[model samples]
Target: MKVGILDSTLREGEQTPGVVFTMEQRVEIAKALSDLGVSMIEAGHPAVSPDIYEGIKRIVKLKREGEITSEILGHSRAVKRDVEIASELEVDRIAIFYGVSDIHLKAKTKTTREEALNVIADVVGYAKAHGVKVRFTAEDATRTDLNYLVRVAKTARDAGADRISIADTVGILYPTKTRELFSYLVREIPGVEFDIHAHNDLGMAVANALAAVEGGATIIHATVNGLGERVGIVALQSVAAALKYHFNVEVVRLDKLVSVSSLVEKYSGIPTPPNFPITGDYAFVHKAGVHVAGILSDPRTYEFMPPETFGRSRDYVIDKYTGKHALKDRFERLGVKLDDREMEQVLAKIKSSQGTRYFRDVDLLEIAEEVTGKVLKPRPPERIEAVVSVKCGSNVYTTSVTRRLSVIPGVKEVMEISGDYDIVVRVEARDSTELNNVIESIRSVKGVESTLTSLVLKKM
Candidate 1:
């Protein structure tokens, strides 16, 4: 059976503490997910507020208008009112969940097992009667008694629920236990589609989800950037890449994964960790000498999934661990070729530069010029200076432009001066060609309107 994804970034992910999405952000995220070809987008829990209800309705409208191909689903509790809120939106599917484990039933819901079963059946039946698809989730299912869980699943199915979801609410399941649970349910339940909603409390969400898929789960619940209540749920980027690269299961459009993830990261206010899998800042960056050398020769040597598969590019960090091969490759990419002697000098200078964290393309170029006693281009000048003036739209733009300009290789200083120009920039270059290139780059900045440059004939 083909595995499907139900992205719950809007529903569960928003439950992350201090995380809230505007209605516009919710619709944008839903559209991004649909564009990425997700099987379903759990828009949000409409019972939370009227604004959220309207947002879900808008997503449904988008789907009906053929703007988004994926199905729109809404979250609900195993209560008549919650299901009613979801049904009013006319969503494609309604995901209704109830606490099933002994602890949850005793303390959380304060209801008996039989009463919980009735609630599930009533809500599932009500949602089904409305002709919208129903997915009945057993919250804390992994922690529940197996026989009782089976009975609950049967109750929902007999009442006409379309699917069953087993939630590892506390993220306690490892791969082995996850496999056993799904295997037993698939064998006993017979013909009912099982979905896995694994959390990351113990940091095993992705692993357990995959194990569930192995044991016959047809759908997996995920959130972009892994945003959720506590430690969050399975990350969509991690699971999608793992499924395709490891199990050869093609679920969503891998190319759009990064873009979708970035959009979520931007709106959710949750920064994707540098070390996060697949779409993180440093996920595809190589640093060590050996690894960089291997990557330079063949990326497959150190990288299992190519960055391009997820619309990301691979980069090598130039630091103390950098190898000559990596340095040479970087130089070649910048269109600067260094001879063997010049390469050594530059390498030695890089190694000797105390407390240097890393080098950018411009940094390397400056180093090469310093080592060779010549500029990159022929006919080097003794010294070149230029004064640049910038007109910015706002204080934010002026501040941002000044910060970016101060980091360029040849820039001496940048000041936010008031007059006709919002900022004045001073740059020193080894040659006229380098001066022109730097000035053009400064003019190309997003906020810069125009610039006037004057050469320094002599510095007293």
Candidate 2:
């Protein structure tokens, strides 16, 4: 299973509206993705200009801290100046591109088929002269004439281009078309690796990339949040996840998927779509009753993949839709059992309440104690005596409650804080310090959301 992941977010992702990354932002994202273990990172296209040139160098300098799976590379047109910048950066590879489509040739390059091949041969040779690997991409190959595509690709091969990328630019190629195009590249373009870079207008970028891979394309290009020009590029998270889960090929580490996506989203000012595959906030969030039920029963039953694999958790969202069994299971784990009817009542009470991180098993027990005065403890303390208060949610209606106390050393007397106590407590402790500990412990209790602790002003 040959696998490689190329992060194009810096080059393509920065093209999104309101998206800009400072040199520091690009360096940090590069280090983080390098730590994520991608085999290749497209640092940026140096042909963009000198400022972009310096940013790529910054990332290249940061790579010396330690070796990671990702090696930084730059994108460029098939030209001498672009290849020279890559040489200056000391990058690992250069994606020297040519707009192969007749449309682009007539409008942009204004060159004949023979002339285009010369440019491909000249620039790739220039890059090879500087000891840089070169990848030749037939820009808009999906729309280019097959004969010219073959001719230009052969030119790149003769010039020592290491890989050929068949770009499905504009997301125009569906699976069948993409697979056919890649199949042709594999058969016709001899002695070079082929890659597929797809866009997402029709939302088949990942499928197309995979189809190309199965058709003998070795590398898949992606961006963290699918951030790129227009409809965005193939998502790094989706393609990496698909390869791991579907093909049983382990290439990229899923754990850093969220971190990389998050940093790019932050720096690029593009919040990950809530429903984006894997990294979205709602990717593993469960709210529906059956979905939560299925998750609680067997997470794998309802989930396509485990959330924790991507540095996320399978979260059972609490809501009006949250089931009683979920809450009952929450209590049963704490050695407390409630009848279905009792849990029904408890769930109702919680549904009626708001603004909390869901109750823990212990909280359910406390609720049970408050409502029915049922002590859920399996072993009630012998000589057990403690103050009990009545609370409806948070409002304690009475000023006092009865308390019974006993001591292990068998103290003959119980002390009570009289009427002034707001609510009285009669308890036993080993000594004065122990007594203070008991008082402080209860003071920290939650239903008593606030506390005012004071030692007796003067001993009786």
Candidate 3:
């Protein structure tokens, strides 16, 4: 069976406290998910406000315009008013949900089991009658009594709901229990499509979703970056990669995963942890000496999934524990070829540093040059001095040009002079090549009409 993804980044994900997506950001995310081949995009609930209603309408228009291929769904409660608002938005599907557990019904909705079922039947029937698909959700399904959950499922099914969603609303379900619950539901509610919406409070959201799939669930609800209430739901990147790599189940475009995650993280204002799976900053980085050596030899030795699979490249971080192989690879990538002796010297320096800190590319190059007694690039001369006069089109450009010239690599100082020159600059270089390059850099600055350079033959 082909498992489909129901991305709720704009719906349940926006429910994350302190998280809000502008209307444009919502549309952009929907388009990106559609392009990524997601089966459905749950735009926010229309009943929330006119802004959300307009957002859903815009998504529907995108689908109609053929800009997006995925079906757009709007969320709603098991209330007639909610369903009516969703119908007005004209989404491809309407997700009608109601709290079925005893606690939620008592403390939240304050409705009896019978009354809740009646409400589900009415809303499901209303949504179906409006010529739109209906997905019924049993909010807090894992905590609800099995008998009551079955009755609620049967009520929605009989009332013409197209699909049923079992939400681990509080993330209380684990792998084994999730499998068992879905297995029972799939057996009892035969012929009805089932979706799983797992939360991540227990950090098992992805695992539980996979378990549900093994037990016959065909749809998995997830949010990009796992953005949602109190922790969040299953992360789209994690679950999609798990489904593809672990289960050999292809759901969405794997390569587009990282881009989607980045887009959501930027617009959502919720930064993803560096250790977050798949899309995290450190997810594909290797720092340990042994691991780096293994990865350098063959990436598959230490990595289960290649970074290229998600549009990311493996990063070999250099620190105190870096191996010779990793260092050699890094030097080659930087266009600095190091011989065996030179390589060992650089490695020794890194290991003996006062504090264990990673070296930047420039720092590493400098270290390599120092150890090899060779310069990768020409260095500025130590004692030579020169005066540069810069002419600018306007006084407005003089200060800016002086500021620019003051920061060039070989520039020692800059001053605005009242002579024929607009600005007088003093520079020093180790060799003619370095001085010439610095002069060229100064000439290249915008608003500089011309420059005259005079070298000091002898600096007594």
Q: Rank the candidates by TM-score, best first.
A: 1, 3, 2
Residue-level lDDT of model 3, residues 240-323, one tens digit each, is 999988779778998998778867866665657678899887889899899999988899998889899888899878888998
| Model 3 whole-model lDDT (C-alpha atoms) | 0.87
Best by lDDT: 3
So what's the TM-score on candidate 3?
0.81
Which prediction has more favorable TM-score, 1 or 2?
Answer: 1
Of the two candidates 1 and 3, the one with more favorable lDDT, higher being better, is 3
Model 2 poorest 10 in a row by lDDT: 400-409
Residue 393, candidate 2: C-alpha displacement in angstroms: 44
lDDT of 2 by residue, 33-108 (tens): 8888878899898778666788888888777656444778898887788787778888888888889898988999
Question: Where does candidate 1 stray beyond 4 Å?
Answer: 378-460
**Number of the top candidate by TM-score?**
1
What lDDT tens digits, residue by residue, belong to model 1 across residues 1-460?
5798999999999999857788888899999999888898999999999889989998999999999889888899988888888998999999999999999999999999999988888889998998999989999999999999999999999988778999999999999999999999999997589999999999999999999999999999999989998999999999999999878987889989877876776566566667889887788999998999998889999999889888889988998788799899888877777899998888888888889888866678888988877778532225677787877765444775676566455777899988888988888887888999888767755467888888878768
Candidate 1 versus the native: TM-score?
0.82
Please give the clash total of every predicted structure, in order: 0, 0, 3
